[model samples]
Target chain A: MIRFEGITKRYDQQTVISDISFEIEKGELVVIIGSSGCGKTTLLKIVNRLIRPTSGRVYINGADTAAQDEIELRRNIGYVIQQTGLFPHMTVRENIEIIPRLKRVNRADVEARSVELMRMVGLDPAQFLDRYPSQLSGGQQQRVGVARAFACDPEVILMDEPFSALDPLTRVQLQDELADLQARVRKTIVFVTHDMDEAVKIADRICLIHEGGVVQYDTVEAVMKYPANEFVADFIGRNRIWSSPAFIRARDIMIQTPVCASADTTVMRCIERMRTRKVDSLLITGENMRMLGIISAREMQTCEDRGVPVSRVMRRQFEKVSPDENIVEVLQIVNRGGLSAVPVLDEAGTVVGLITRSSLLTTLSRPYLDETEAATS
Target chain B: MNLFTFLVQSAGEIATRLFQHLQLTLLSIFIATALGVPLGVLISYRRRMKKPVMGVANVVQAIPSIALLGFLIPILGIGEKPAVFMVVVYSLLPIIKNTVTGLSGINAETLEAAKGIGMTRIQVLTKVKLPLALPVIMAGVRISAVTSVGLVTLAAFIGANGLGYLIYSGIRTLNDYQILAGAVPACLLALLMDFLFSLVEKMVTPACFKQN
Candidate 1:
């Protein structure tokens, strides 16, 4: 874990970072984001002791970084930059093995580790190991850069817009790969970038900064749903969440008070409740709000017996989602199953909310409508 | 006698003077590289020293080769010492200038990455900065090497034995053949120095810098 205690930095008279404080838990991938000149990079450099904070202490796992030897401290943390700073003169294998060689690791182990890293980053070690950095494409070079960072198995990895220099297609590919790699390795990673979409795509928690001060440091969902202020809302943009559909969970956009009926409720009563609530479906529940099944208005319209309980008429084997399931999966289930309404169930099988086709449509189009409202108002 | 007959007859003396001229040139170049490269690296880190050190080099370079020999003769009497000293002083400018340029001209991003990766200051200089700057520094050495060949002929003025002795003695006697013998060989030696250093330059250039 890394904690920044009231960190503030000044250059002569101008303040770059002002009294910022936050703690990143171990194995968490936190992305620090801000506009250009907002000191996001400075904040990252301080953790590695490349830029010393004017005041305040940075503690890495209960040890004050200010007291540690800067070189030794840096060796224990991996760093990757936007420019992909692989030594041009060194071959890819040599570049990846630098830190290990510096630490005087066994030569054979370092070589084997480098080959494994190359394969981990999705580069073919046999073909790429002997090639100079100049021979590799930009994306490939950054891949080697990433492999080099992981060469020593450092506890913390600091990535300063590592993928920002790549083209859009390569950037997305690397982002997905990095997210996958982070999941498997679970390193404490602190990534800094100005792009909100990139932050939302991979960050476990997004640290939003403005004017050298943190505006909000929260999970991706919270930051998207409840932006701290006008600056954050604008910076995050109205439609930013839509770009990363995975952050949009069923609980976030589902209708909270879905028209629900007891399993023993008569089919006629269920139809009546659906009509009054202006919903096309009724979520049939058992004791303690346990979701049993769902009955659509079409099923009610074709019912032969008006007095039959909803349990007999309701469809049990229907698509359902957990509250935490992302909207993308929800959309896929809805699209594949031809679901009119999908009940969101929490633990204990209780129906917490309902995501209807209409609700999904409104949530998808909210950003454009908000934009239109803003322009006219 | 014609220049060709005079040259053939005095082949033995020509060969002896030529050997002395080669020694004088190589020794001065060696001394200059030893002193100049470190000075250049020093000034690259110590910004305050760059202007004064470069100023001294420029002033020495501007001095006529004969005047430099004349100045050195007072401190270290005539012969190989003053001759080599004159050539060494004259060659310092290119060597020092190129070293400073090469070291400073490395990409800033590359150096930042080097430091960011936890290399010590010395490691950064030796591993990243110097290797990248080798070609430029070698270019400086090439310039000095070629110039040293011509400069060493001036050593003959301080009574250091060399091809210059042949030319200077021939000048006093107005012997065209003797002057041709000395002048022709010195010109060829300058070209030879340039060719030799160019080969070293190619060999030392890193693979990444090579086109194919």
Candidate 2:
């Protein structure tokens, strides 16, 4: 855990950070979100004593960081920055193993740790271990940066827009990987990024700063549902928030236990399920209860007339979404494909629920409705 | 007599002059690198001192090589020492200027990363800054080597031994073969040293620095 008390950083006549104070709990991923020059980077540097605050104290694990030797303090704290900051002279293995080597860990143990760390970050140890930073792509260099941070096994890690330099696809991929990696091996991470969307994806708590001050710092759910003021609402883009719900998942609003039948079922059975559910289509569940295809009543009628199984008539190319995905993506799929609905599958590939177009419209209009009602009062 | 016959007959004298030329150039360059590189690295770190440091180097470079040797002769007395001393003064400009430029040219991002990852100031300089700056610094050294070889030919003025002695004596005696004996080898020596230093520069420079 880390705590900042009355931290104000002034550079000559201009103040970089103005009396900001906050606490990050253990195993929490706190994102410092702001536009560039909002002092997010300056704030991160203050944590590791890279920048000394003009006033106030920073405590890491309940010890005043100012009292500690800067190098000794930084040695136990992982610091990653934008541009991947990889030592160009060092190979991937050497870059990852640098901290351990600095700590004077045995060479064999360091090599062993390097292999493990590379695997943990989804890099192939055999192929990339001996390669230079220039040899790898931008994303690979940042992954190596992450591995280097974890090499020392520091209690806390600070990342300053680690993914900004990467392309969009690589950025998204690395974000998902980092989220999954953090879930498995939770460290108290303080991430700084100028992007609001990235913060929403990765942060447990978002600390939105503006002009060297904290605008709002709270759980992502709270920040979305209750933005505290007009500034917070405007800063997070009011239109986007109102239109696209935050902290929403497919499973949260999906109609549970959608009408379904086995893929091997006859057209007669598919018709019965569709009639009972008062729907036009029947979700055909295949092996392991996964949604294999959709059998429309029209298709089922054709199968019935032809005296064949529903599997022979069902549409096998229907799109499905994971349970944890946001409703924005679900609506996009529905709108783009002109589909009435899409199945929501859980991690096991089981059809947990169905996302209908009607369902999305109802959910999307509630915020505006509430605003209208609040205005009347 | 032909140029070959002249060289063959006076081969002993030519060989001695070659050794002396090598000795004068090499000693001057050795001292220049030893003193210049550190001073260059120092000036790089101290922003306030850069103008004054570079200003001194520029003035030294502006003095003609013969003039430098002549100026040192009065203070240090005419000999190999005065000859070596002035070459060092003349060569210091390139080595120091390049050293300063090389260190400054390193990516600021790389330096920041070095510090962020808990590198001590000394370690950052030695491990990151210097290795990254190696090619540029070696470039400076190469410049120093080539110029030193050319300037050592003028050492003949200060009673120092070199192939220039043959050229000076040949001019006095109006002997064409002797003039070629001194003139040809001095030009060849400069080329040879340039080639060799280029090899060294390649050896010391990391492949990463070469690309950018």
Candidate 3:
């Protein structure tokens, strides 16, 4: 078990993490979720002695991390960062063999271990043994990063936003890969991310950090069901609704018959549809019903000057949420991406409906307002 | 100047010159690498000592090889001793600088990983740090080797038998053929040594060290 006892880290006069305490059992995956500057990263660094606490202690299997030789202490823990941090000059095989070589393992043993690690991380040894880090894509680089960390069969792993650099699809794939890898390796893992869906997906226990301390740490279901305070409620955002937004999908909240414009449709015609439907944006679809772009009502006023087709003035990079995505995820997608609304797409990537900022806000606010009304009554 | 006659006449001279050139250049580099690498490693670890050690190396590098040879002749006299001493001094900077740079350039993450794996200090240095530092150090050695080859040619000023003798003789007699003979072999030797050492560096370094 890894334990942090009253860990307090201060930078100058201000505290970054103050008197934080937690225990992670072997084979458990604990995730810390918080907004930026919430000290989740600082807390993980403290466990590895990368950043030492000012007044508290970290113990690995009951031995104080501060008291142990730092080098030896670090060797027992695997660390993965969002950047992957793979050594740029080394080949994938060499990167994985680093820890084994450091342990003075026999040459044959090191090679064998490297091959196994490469295979374990899903990189074919034959194909990638000589390939350098720069040659791999972002997702592949992260796999090599993971392989390097697990090189020595470390018992505990610390991951700080390891998959945050990848695209959403790649992020989801890697998260699943991580879950599988963790199940097999069974290392005590402390993962940090600001994404709640990712935290909920993989965490055996979730710790919600706020103002440099853990506001809530419990099972994923428990944390979602019973948030500790208003900060967590706000941080988790849209999930504190009494009906629990987890059960509501984007399809339920989305407008089924969304106003859409075609590529050949005139700008004036598109404006008429927006005005008649009273919608701020219209999805521009292609012949095969593929999403082309989104044209906002504001663009219609300047449509003639901006013109060629609806496609000319439409926003190509627009927010999209899947029909299967829960309302909380949709809200997160809207809020995090700073979009006023998002188009809900089916499995085929065709726009099914639209979800607006006001609809989501109403859905999220209803439960809290109802509670306030009950108190007043 | 018949080809057969030319070969028969210069065979002994060519053999003698080749052996001598190889002996002088190799001997100086061996000595410099032996002495400079450790000093570089030592100074690299101690922040305060780096400037002083590099200062000494820089001063040694600044001394012209002919001047150093001429100065050394007074104390050690003519022949291989003065020549070897001068080549060794000239080769120190690259070897020492590369060694320090190589050791210091080891990835901090790799070092942390090494420590995380339960390796002792000595184990980490020997296995992780030294192996990773090998390429940079080899680069240094390559520079030292080439520099030694060029500097050893100047050693002929002190009567040492090497390719330098042919160049000095050519200059004295104004024989273009003799000068070509000296200059060609020296350049070829430097290139040959570089290629050979690079192969050796590659072989000694594990494939993993190439990832970056």
- In Å, residue A364's CA in model 1 sits off its true spot by 3.6
Which segments of model 2 are wrong by more than 4 Å? A239-246, A249-362, A366-377, B209-212
Please list all clashing residue pairs in model 2, or write none if there are none.
none
Error of 3 at A335 (Å): 31
Better of 1 and 2 by TM-score: 1
TM-score of chain B of each: 0.96, 0.95, 0.91
Cα lDDT of model 1 by residue, A29-76, tens digit: 999999999999999999999999999999999999999988899989
lDDT of 2 by residue, A1-377 (tens): 89989999999999989999999999999999988888999999999988889999999999999999888888899888875488898789878887678779999989998999999999999999998888889999999999998988888999989999999999989998999988988999999998877887788999999999998999986787678898888777754455446467787779897888888887877787788879987788888788788877776665535446778888988888998888778878888999888899887878999888777888777778877987899
Number of the top lDDT candidate: 1
Q: Give the clash count for each candidate.
A: 0, 0, 13
Q: Write the per-residue lDDT of candidate 1 for residues B1-212, one digit (tens) a residue.
A: 77778888999999999999998888888999999999999999999999999999999889888877787877999899888888899899999999999999998888888898899999999889999899999999999999888887777878998899988988989888888899999999999999999998988788999965
Q: Which candidate should be chosen as best, given TM-score against the real structure?
A: 1
Q: What local lDDT score does residue A162 receive in model 2, on the 0 to 100 scale? A: 96
Q: What does DockQ come to for candidate 3?
A: 0.16
lDDT of 3 by residue, B55-126 (tens): 988998888777888889889999999899888888888989998998898767656655544557777667
User: Where is the poorest 10-residue window by lDDT in model 2 chain A?
Assistant: A238-247
**Could you give the DockQ of candidate 1?**
0.69
Quality class of the docking in candidate 3, CAPRI style: incorrect
TM-score (all chains, Cα) for each model: 0.92, 0.79, 0.67
